[model samples]
Target chain A: MEPGMISLAGGNPDLAGLPLDALGDAASALIREHGTEVLQYSTGAGIDELRTELTRVMARAGIEADPADLLVTAGSQMALELITAMYCDPGDVVLAEGPSYVGAISTFMGLEAEVSHVPCDADGIVPDALEARIAELRAAGKRVKLLYTIPNFNNPSGITLAADRRPRIAEICREAGIVLVEDDPYGLVRFEGETVPAIRAADPSVIYLGSLSKIFSPGIRIGWVLAPREVRDRLQLLSESTTIHASTLSQHLALTYLRDFDWSGHLDRAIVRYRERAEALLEALPSALPAGSTWTRPSGGFFVWATLPEGASADELFALAAEEGVVFIPGSGFYADGQGERELRFSFSLESPERIREGMTRLARASERYARR
Target chain B: MEPGMISLAGGNPDLAGLPLDALGDAASALIREHGTEVLQYSTGAGIDELRTELTRVMARAGIEADPADLLVTAGSQMALELITAMYCDPGDVVLAEGPSYVGAISTFMGLEAEVSHVPCDADGIVPDALEARIAELRAAGKRVKLLYTIPNFNNPSGITLAADRRPRIAEICREAGIVLVEDDPYGLVRFEGETVPAIRAADPSVIYLGSLSKIFSPGIRIGWVLAPREVRDRLQLLSESTTIHASTLSQHLALTYLRDFDWSGHLDRAIVRYRERAEALLEALPSALPAGSTWTRPSGGFFVWATLPEGASADELFALAAEEGVVFIPGSGFYADGQGERELRFSFSLESPERIREGMTRLARASERYARR
Candidate 1:
C-alpha cells in the first residue's frame, strides 16, 4: 500500500493488542532458565510443552487428540502443504469451500493438485451441497483426495459452519473415505458465537489445524496439525527434510508464554476489543455501502464478506479503490475459478473503530464512483 | 541414541557453544523497544537489517549482492526447495554432487524432479567431469536444469571446492546455461582453510544459499538465498503464501542480534571450539581405524567423511556399531543412488574430545568386528 492508503485487506492480528510485556517477560525467563535448549537444535516433533498445550487448547474446542498425534509446523500453512503433499498426487481432486483462504488455495495449487470448490451459503459449507458434490465428483470418476475447510469463522466469508452441519459433513467424509482438513485458525477468536463441536470431535479421521497466530502471536510462526499417525509421520519426514522443525526459539517462546501468560485474560480482552471494532464495521456497513451491497453479519473473526451490486465486479473497481485511498482484497483473488467477481473481503483485524469507519467511508465513495461509471 | 551411547552423528552447533546470553539480551531489548512492529505482519523480502548484514557478510566471501537479491528462508533447505521449485518442473533434471546433503536429494525427489548425480573428488566437483556430464545429458535430450553443489565445507563429504576450480565450474555452468546453487551454510564455520572466493563471485547467475545455522544458531532456522530478481520474486511469493516469512520473531531476533551482538567475536569462539572438536576426531581416526580407511581432512565444518576399506560396506558395520553403543551416519544415507557403501561420515560437532575419542574407539572395535567377518 501507498503511505496514505487505508488497508482493510490484511487478516493479521490486532497490532495494538499484542501482549508486549508478557512476551518480553516470557522471553527473558525462557532464555535465563532454558537458554541452551531453546537456542540449540531441537528434534522430535517440537518442544513438548507447546504440543501438550495445543492438545489442551484443542480440547476446549471439543477436539480430543493425543499429543503424540500432533505435529508442529512453521504455521498452519505448512501443515496445509504437508497434508496436500501427503494425500494428493498432482491432478488429484481436492475440495474446498467456494471462496476459500487464498493461502490454502495457493498451497493446493502449488502442490499441483486440482482444487474443486463446493458451493456454500451464509452458514459456512452447506452439508447437502457438499455431499451432493462429492457424489457427483465420484460419479464422474474424479478421485476426491480431501475436503479442506475453515469451518469456524471461515477466512473471507466470516461465516461459522452451522452447529448441525459439522457432524453431518464429518459423517459424509467418513463414509466417503475422504479425509477432511478442519482448519480452525479463527475458532477461539469469536466474541458472540456459541462454540460448536469440531469436525475432528465428530470424526477422529479429520485432520485439524490450529494456530496461535490468530490469538497469541503469528510472529512465532507456530501452529500444529492433529492428524492420524500415518499423516503425522509423513509431515514429520517433510519437516525433517525441510525446515527441520519449527524455529526452536519460537517454540520455546510460545511454550513459555503459554505456561506463564494469562491466556484467558488476554483472549477475553481480545474478544471485547474485536467485538467493538466488529460492531463498528457492522453498524457502518448499512449506511456506507451502496443499496444493493450485502455482507455477512459475522459474530467474530477478522473479515466481513461484502457483495457489491449485481453487475459490478470488485476487480473493475480495484484501481478506483486505490485512487480513493482504500485497500481491501478483491473477491476474485479468493475464488478458485475466478467466481467472486462481484465481491470483496474487508478485514477488521487491524484498524480501530474510527479508522475502520473512515476506511469504509472511502470504500463507499469508491463504490459510488464505480456505480456512476 | 541410548542414554549411555556417545554420538558422533549430529551435524549441529554445540549445545554449550551457542551465544545464549547475547541472544537473550537481543530478545529482551527487541520486545521492549519494538514489540508491536516486531510482532506485527512484516511486508517485503525480510528484515532489512538482516538482509543488509547478509550483504556485508557475502562481501567477506568475495561475493557482491544487493539486499534486494536476497530472500530469507526457514533454512538453506527451504532455499534449496524454493530454487528447485522455481527452476524445474516435475521430471526436469536436477544434478547434484555424488554425495550431497540427503535433505536436498529428498526435496528434489519430493518435488518429483529427476535427480542425477555428478561425481566429485576430494576438492569437490571435478569441473571437467561436470562439463562432460552436462554435455552427455544435453546430448541425450535431457533438459539440464540446475547443478546443486555445497562448495563450502560440503555436508557429508567435508570437501571444499578448490579456489581455482570455483571459477572453472562457474564458467562451465554459465556456458551450459545451467544455474548453479552454491550452498554455503558452513562457509563461515571455517577454522583452518584459506578463504576462497565463492563460485557466485565468479558467476553472479549462481543462486547462493547461506545459513546462520552453522555460525550463529540453528534453532532460529535463519537462512537466505541470493538470486536474480526473478528467482527472488518467486521465493517472496512462496514465502508469503507458505511459512509467512520465516517466523517474524526469529527474523527480528536475528536482526537485533546482528546489530547488538559481538558477532565476529562469537564466530571466533565457535571456530576455536569446532576446530578443537574436529582435530580431536581427526587425530583419533588414524590410530583407532583399521588400515586402508582414509578420511577427508576437513579444515572446517562438521563432518569427517571416512572411506571404509575397499569391498567393505559401512552398512554392514552399522548394526555392530549400534550394539557397541556408538552412533554415526552411514555414508549410504547421504548418497542419491546408495553408492557410498564403503563409507561413513563422522560428525565431530556435538560431542567433546574425550567423548569423540571414546566413540571412535568403539567405531574401531565395531569396524574390526565387521572387517573380521
Candidate 2:
C-alpha cells in the first residue's frame, strides 16, 4: 500500500499485546529440549500431545471431541479444503451463507465444487431458509453434499448464529443427510456476548473446525478438525498425502504456548483491545456512512458488514476510498455470484481505535464525495 | 516398535549433528526482533526474501529459478499434489518410477489420478523406457499428464538419474506433452557424486521442487516449486485456497537460518554422519543378505534398495525381521502394481552406524530364517 494508507481490508489479528518476547524464550527452550523429535517428521495423524491438548480447547467451546477423531491441519482453511475434496465432487452443491468467508468460497471453487448460498439474517442462517435452499437444490437434481457455516462471528459479516438456531440447523442438515461443517475460528474470541454452545455440541456428526490463530498465533498455523470416525479417517489420509502434516515446529510451538503460557490471560487482554476497536468502528459507522446505509454491530470478532444506501455502488466507493488514502474490501468479493455490489466489509482487527476512527472519518468524506458524484 | 527394535523404515534426517542450541537461540532472537511480521499471515506467494533465498539454493543444483516463477509450499509433497490437482483429471495417468516415493503415489491416489510405473534401473529412470512407456500409453488412448521423478537419490530406491539421460527424458516428456515434475527433496543432501544438472535446468518447462526438509529441517516444513509462469500462478492459487500459506514463523525461521547461519556448513557435517551410516549399512548388507541378493550402492541421500534372491518373499522376511527386533519397509508398498514382493528398502538416514549394523544383523537372521521356512 502507499504511504499513510489506513487499511481496513485485511482481517489479520492484532499482535501488539501478544507475549512475543516471552513466547520467543519459550520457543527457544522447546526447540532446545525437544529438537530431535520436533525437527523430525511426525505421524501423519499429527503429534499425540497437540491433539490431546486440542480436545481441551474444544471442550472450552462446549464440544466434547475425542483426540482420535481430531486431525491437526495447517489451518482450519486446510480442514475445509480436505472436507470439500473428500465429499464434494465436481458440480456438487455446497451451501454456505450468501456472503461467506472468501477463503472458504475460493476453496470450493478451486475444487470445482458449486457453491449455493443460503440466506442469513442478523442471527445467522435462518433455519427455514437453510431447509428451503436444500430442498430447492434437491428438486433441481443437484447434490447438496455440505453446508459450510461460520457459526460464530463470521468473517466479513460479524453475525453470530444465534444459540437457539444452532441445534435447529444441525438437525435440518442431519435429516437432510448433508454434512454440516461448523467453522469456529472466532468462537472463543467473544468480548461481551454469552457463550453460544457449538452446533457440534448437540450433533456428534457435525465436523467442527477450531483454530488458535485468533487467540494464540496465526504464524504457527495450527488448526484442527473434529469429525465422525469415518470422516476423520479419510481426512487423515488426505492430510497425509498432501502436506504430510502441519509443520512440526509450529505444532510444538503451539503446544508449548498452550502448555506453559498464560494463554487465556493473553486472549482476555487482546479481547479488550478488539472490543474497543469494534466500538470505534461501530460508533463511527452511523455518521460516516450515508443516510439509509446500514451495518452490523458485532459484539465480537473482526468485521462490520455495511450495505451502502440503495443505488450507491460499493465498487465506486472503494475507488474513492483509495483516493482518500484508506482501503477496504468491496463486498462483492465475498459473494460467489457478485450480488454484494452495494455492500462493503470493514475490518477493525488490524487497526487501533484511533486509526479506525480516523479511517472512518476518511470513509465519511469519501462517501460524501461519492454521493455528490 | 517394541523396546530394542531397530527401525530402518523411516527416512528421517539425523538431527544429532545439527546446531540445536545455536538454532534455538536464533529462533528466540528472530521471534524477539521480528515478532509482529513473523507472527502474521504472509502473502500467498510466500515471503519475498525466502523465495529469493530459494533461488540461490536451487542454483546450487544448477537450476536458474526466477523468484517470480516460484511458489513456496508446505513440502514438495504439496507441490506434487497441487500439480496433480491442476493438471491431472481423474483417470488421467501419472507416470512415476517403478519404485517411487510412497508419499507421491499416495497423493496421486488421493486425488483419484491413475499412477503408472515406468520401470527403473540402478541409474534411475531409463530414458528409453520412459519414452516407450509414454508411447504405449498414448497408443492405448490414455491421457498421460505427468511424469513424477525423484531424480536425486530416490526415497526407496536410492537411485539418481544419470546426467546424460536427464535432457533426453525432458525432451521425451516435452514431445509427449507431459508435465515432468522433478521432486528433488534430497538433491542438496548429497554426500558424494558429481552434481548433475536438474532436468528443469535443461528444460524450464519441467516443474522443479526443492525442499529444505532434507537439508535444513523438516520440522519447519518449507519447500518450493519453480514452474513455468502459468503453472506457478495456478499453484499459488491452489496453495492460497487450501493452507492459505505455509507457517509465517516457519518461513521467517527458514529465512533467518539461510541469512544469518552457515547452513551449508551444517549440511556438510550432516553429510559426514549420513555417509558413515550409509557405509555401515552397505558393509553389513553384503554379509547379512543371502548370496545372489543385491542392493544399490548409493552415493548420497537415504535408503539402500535391495532385491531379495530369486523366489524369496520380502514380506515373509519382514515378519521374521519384526520377530527378531528390526523393521524395514517392504518394497511392494513403493510400487503401484504390487510387483516388488521380493524387494525391501532400508533407510540409513535415521539410525547411527552402530545401530544400522545391529539392525542389519537382525535382518540377516530374519532372512535366513525366512529362507529356511
Candidate 3:
C-alpha cells in the first residue's frame, strides 16, 4: 500500500509516534556494552534485566508480580501459544470473547482445542454469558481449560470490560476452576478515564500478557507473560523447547531502551496522539455512515469496531473500499463462526487524523455505492 | 561465569572471531537506509532479501531448496517444534536418534508425541539397527511419523553420519514412508575433512533445518526451515499463530550483516580458533581420563563426547565437577531411555586452549573423586 493509503488492517503502533532515535541509541549502546553476551545463547527464560524491568512495569500497573513469574517471550502471540500448549489438550474447550484476537483463536485451534465464543457487548464479555457457557459445557462433560479475555481495550471490538465486571468474572473463573488469560497488549494506550484494576489484581489465577509492541515498537518482538509459579515453570519448559528464549539482542536493547528512555512520557505522548486520531474518526463517522449504521467508542487501544445497516456486509465493503485506495479488516475474520458479516474493525493507531478523515470519506462513498445497488 | 572463565558450556560462536567491526558498519548503514521498514513487522515468512541469501547458502551446502519452500523461524528450536506439531499428533510415534539434541527431544515430548529412539553407533544412527527397529514397530501395527537426525556433527555426541550411511538412511526412510528431519546446525562448522551432502539433498522427502546461530551468532535467534511445499505452508500457518514471525529487526540486521560482512572468512577464523581449543582438550584427555575411558575426536562443532568405563556414571561425575566450578551435560539427558550413564558432553566453543587445559585438569580431579567413591 502507498504511504497515503489509510489502512485499518494492521495491529501496528503509530510509526510517527515511535521513538526511532531512542531505538537507534539503545541498539548502539547494547552492542557496544554487551556485544559478547548479546551474540551468545542466553538464559532460556530471557535476559534478567528485561525481566526485572518488566516486573516493575507490571507492579506499577497494579499487577503484583515477581520477575521470577515472568517469561519474556517473542511476543504475546508466543505467550498465548505456550499457555495453550501447557493447558489445552486436543478437544479441550477454550472459552474466549466472541470477537477476539484472530491470532489467539488460530493458536488455540492449531493445538486442536475447541474454541467456544462467549457473547460480549460494548463492555467486553458478559459475565452471565460466560457463566452460562461454562455451565453448559460442564454439564455436557466437556473440559474448559481457560477463559481467554482481552479485558482492557480488546482487539477488533475495542471494548474494555467494566471495572465492576472484573472481580465477578474472576470469581466465576475461580469457581469453575478455569484459568483466566488476560491479554492486555493495549492496556497502556489509555486515551481517557481512570485506570481500572487489571483482572490479574482481581485474582491471582489470571495469566497476564504485556507487550512493548504497542507502546514502543512491534519490530523488536518483545513481550512477557505473568502467571502463577506452576504456569510460569511449565511455560519456561515449553519455551526451552520452542525458541529457547527471546532474542538476547532484542531483550538487551529493550532493557536499555526502558532504562535510558522516559517510557511513561513516551506513552503519554502516544495516548494523546492516538486519542486525537480516534476522536477525529469518531467525529467523521456520522457523515461517513449509512443512516442506521453504528460504531464503537473505545476508551483505549488501537481499534474502532463498526457495524453497518442490515443487509450490508463488511466483507463486501472492504473490497469496495480497497478500490478507492483504502484498506480495512472485515469484522467476520475476528469471529469464531464468521458471524459478524455486518461489522468491521478500523485501526486508528497507524494513520493520522487527516488521513483517517479522508479514509472515512472514501469508505462512505464505497458504502453508498454498495447500498445503492 | 567471569569474563575469562573457561566457559565450555556455551553453544555460541567465537566472539573473538566474529566480524564485530563489520557488523557495526552494517548496523549504521541499515539504519541510515531502511530504519522505518526494519522496525516494522515485515512478513510472517521473513524478509525477502534474507530468504534469497539463505537459499544460496543452502544450495552451496548441497541442499537445493527453493526460497518459496523455506520459512525463517525464531530459531532451530522453533522450526523443530512447528514441524513436530504439523506432522505428529498426540501418541504418534516419532523415531529419533538414540542420543539426540535434548532440546529437540523435549520439543517432541512437549507435543505429546511418543518419541522412540533408534540406536546409533559412533558414526551416528546405525542403518541396520534402524531398519530392525522400524520393522519391529511396523509388525506391532505402530506408525512412525518421522525420523529426526543431526546428520552432520551431532550435538552431545560430536559424531557425524558417515557419507555412505547418509544415502542408505535416506532411502530407508523414503521407502518406509517416514519423513526424515535433517537438522544440520553444525553443517558449516567443519574444521577439517570434506563436507558431507545433507540427507535432504539425497531425499526430497527430508525436511532440513539451517541456522545462522552456529556460524553467525545465536543471540539473533534467526533460523530457517526448508520443507516440502505442503509442510512449509503448514508451518507458515502455525507460525502465524505462534510468534507471528521472527524479529524484523534481527532479520534486517542479519540481511545487512550477511550481505556486507565476510561471513565465510569469519567462519574460517572460528574453525581455526575452535580447532586449537579442541586439540588442547584432546591432548589433555589422556592424562585427565581414567583407564578404559575414551572421548571422540570431533572434526568440527562445539562439543566432544566422552565415555567413562562401564559402571562409572557421568551424572555422578557431573555432580563432583560442579563442586569444582566445572560443568558438563550428562549424556543420559540426551537419550530417550535415559541409558547413557557413562557418557558426558564437553563443549569447546567458549573456552580458549589454555582455559580448556585448566578446565580439563579440574575435570580430572572430579573424575578421580568419582572413581574413588
Candidate 4:
C-alpha cells in the first residue's frame, strides 16, 4: 500500500494492545528456566502442560475436551488443513458457509477437495440451506464428507451463528455422517452479546479448532484441535508425519502467557478498542456508502460484510477506493464459484477509531467516483 | 522411556550447548523492541530479513540461493510436505533411498503417494539402482513425480552422498522429469572431511531444504526451501492457504540468532561433542553386536546404522533390548517396503559419550539374550 493509503483490508488483530514487556519477560524466563524443554524437540501431540491448559481454555466456551484427544498445531489453519486432508478424497465435497473463511476454502481446494457453499444469513449459516446444499451435492453424485463452519464471529462476514442453531447444525451433520469442523478463532473477542456455547459443546464428535492468535499472539503460531479419539489419532499421525510438532518455543510461550498473565483482562481491553473502531466505521457507513448499498452490522468480530449497489463490482470499487487512498478485500475471492462480486469486507480490527473515520471519508469519495463511472 | 533405559533412539541435538542466557536476553529484547512485527501474523513466504539471511546460511554449503526464491517453513519437514502435496497425486510414485528418513517416508504415505525404494550402499543411493528403479516404475505404468534425498549425512543411515555422485543424481532426476528434493538438515554437522558441495549447488533446479534444527534448535522450528521460481510461487500459495506462515516470533528469533549470535561457533562446538559421542558408539560397536553383525562408520550426522545377525528380527531384538534397559529404532519403520527387519538405527546425537558406551554394553547383553532365544 502507498504511504497515503488507509487500509481497511487487513484482518490482523491490534498487537499494540498486548503487554510486550510482560510477554518478553515471560519468553526470556521460559527459555532460561527450561532451555532443554523449550529448545528441544517435543512430542507430535504437543506439550502436555499446554494440552491440559487448553482444556481449561475450552471450558470457557462450554466445550469439554480431553487432553489425550487434543493435538497442538502451528495455528488453527493447520488444524483445518489436517481435518480436510483426512476427510476429503479428491473430488469429495466439503460444505462451507457461503462467504466462508477464505483460508479454509483455499486449504480445501489446495488439497483437491470440492468446496460447495451453504448459503448463510446475518445470523450465520442457515441450517435449512446447509441441508439443501448437502442433499443437492449428494444427489448430484458428490460425496459430501465434511461441513466447515465458524460458530463464533466469522472472518470477513463477522456473522456469528445463532446459539439456537448450533445444536441443530451439529445434529444435521451427525445424521449425514459428515464431520463438523468448527473454527472458533474469534470466539473470545466479543464486543457484545452473551457467549454462545461452541458447536463443539453441543456435539462431542465435532472437530473443534481453537487458536491463541486472536486472544494471545499469532507470532507464537499456537493452536489446538479437539476431536474424537479416532479422528485425533489420525490427525496426530498426520501431524507427526509432516511438521513433526508445532514450534516448542511457541507452545511454551503460549503456556506461559496463559498460566501467568491476565490474558482475560488484556482481551477485554482489546474488545473495547475494537468495539470503538467498529462503532466508528458503522456510524460513517450511512454517509459513506452508495445508494442501495447494504452491510452487516457486526455485534462482535473484526469485519463488516458490505454489499455494493446491485450490479456494481466491488473489484472495480476496490480499484477506485485505492485511488482515493482507501482499500479493502474484494469479495469474489471468498466464494467457491464466481459469486460475491458485488460484496467486500472492511476490517475494524487494526485501525484506531479516528483512522477508521478518516478511512470512511476516503471510501465515500471513492464510492461517489465509482457511482459516476 | 524408563528411568534406567539408555535410549539411543532420539535424533535430537544437544540443547545444553546453546548459550541460553544470551539467547533468552535476545528473545526478550526481540519482542520488547519489535513486538508488533514479532507478534503479528506474517507473510506465508516469510519475513524478508530472514529470507535474505538464509541465503548466507546456504552459502556455507556452496548453494547459492535468492531470497525471492526462498520460503521459510515450520521446519524442513513442512517444506517436504508442501513439495509432496504439490507434486504427488494419489498413486503417484515417489522414489527414496532404500532406508530413507522415516519422517519423509511417513509424509509420502500420509499424502497418499506411493513410495518406492532405490537401494543404497555406504556411499549413499547408487546411481545405477536409482536408474533401475525409475525404469522399472515407469514400465509398471507408475507416474513417478518426485525423488526425495538427503545428500548430506542421511538420517538413520548416516551415509552422505559422495560429492561426485551429487551432480549425477540431479541429472538422473532432471532427465526423468522428476523434481529432485534435497533435505539437508545435517549438511553442516560434519565431524570430519571438507564440506561437500550441495546437490543444489551442482543443479540449481534441485529443490533444496535446509534446517536450523540440527545446527541451532528444533524448538524454534525454522527451515527454508530454495526452489525454482514456479515451484516457490505455488509453495508460497500453499503455505499461505494452510498454516498461513511460520511462527513470526520463531522467524524473528531465527533472524536475530543468525544476525547477532556466534551461531557457527556454537555449531563447531556441537560438532565436536557429537563426534565424541559417535566415536564412543563406533568404538563399542564390535563387542556390542552379534558375531556376524555389521554397521556403518559415519563421518558426520546422528545415527549409526547396524545390521543384526542374518535372519535375526530387529523388532524382536528391540523387545530384548528394552528388557536390557536399552532402546534403538528398528529399521523397518524407515523403509517403504518391509525389507529392513534385520536392521536398526542407533542415534548418538542426544546422549553423552559415557552414556553411549553404557548403552552399547546394554545392547550387547540384549543381543546375547536374543541369540540364546
For model 2, name the residue pairs that clash. none
Evaluation by DockQ, superior candidate among 1 and 4: 4
The C-alpha interface RMSD of every prediction is: 1.6, 0.9, 1.7, 0.9
The order by descending DockQ is: 2, 4, 1, 3
How do the residues B1-373 of candidate 1 rate in per-residue lDDT, one tens digit apiece?
5898988887878757556666667687778778877766676488888899988888878998899899998888887877787788878898998787988999888877888888788888888899989988889888989999988888988899999888898889888889899999888889895888888886788999998887777888989999989888988887766687788878887776677677777788878888888998999899666688899998888988888788877877778888888988888867767689988888888888888888888978987888688
Of 3 and 4, the candidate ranking higher by DockQ: 4
TM-scores for all predictions: 0.96, 0.99, 0.97, 0.98
Worst 10 residues of 3 chain A by lDDT: A17-26
lDDT by candidate, in order shown = 0.84, 0.89, 0.85, 0.90
By DockQ, who's the top model here? 2
In model 3, the runs with Cα more than 4 Å from the true position are A2-4, B1-7, B28-33
Docking class of 3: medium
Query: Per-prediction RMSD in angstroms?
Result: 2.0, 1.0, 1.8, 1.3
Pairs with backbone N, CA or C atoms under 3 Å apart (clashes), candidate 3: none
Q: Considering the two chains of model 4, state its CAPRI-style docking category.
A: high
**Candidate 2 local lDDT, A1-373, one digit each (tens):** 9989999999899888888899889888877888887887888787888999899888888888889999999998999998999998899999999789999999998788998989999999999989888989999999999999998889979999999998899999999999999999998889986888899998999999999889888877889999998999989999988889999988988888888888889889999999999999899989888779999888788988999888989999999989998899989889888789999899999899999999989989998998799
Query: What lDDT tens digits, residue by residue, belong to model 3 across residues B1-373?
Result: 6444455675667776676655654655555456667767779998888998898778767877789988999998899998888888888889987778889888888778878998888888999999999999989888788899988888878899999999999989988999899999998899899988888887777899999998887888999999889889889888878889999988988887777778888888989998998999889988776668998888899888889998888888887877776777888888867778888888888778988898888888987887788
**True contacts recovered per prediction:** 0.75, 0.85, 0.60, 0.86
- By the DockQ metric, which is better: model 2 or model 4? 2
Off by over 4 Å in 1: A2-4, A139-141, A316-324, A367-371, B139-141, B368-373
Ranking by TM-score: 2, 4, 3, 1
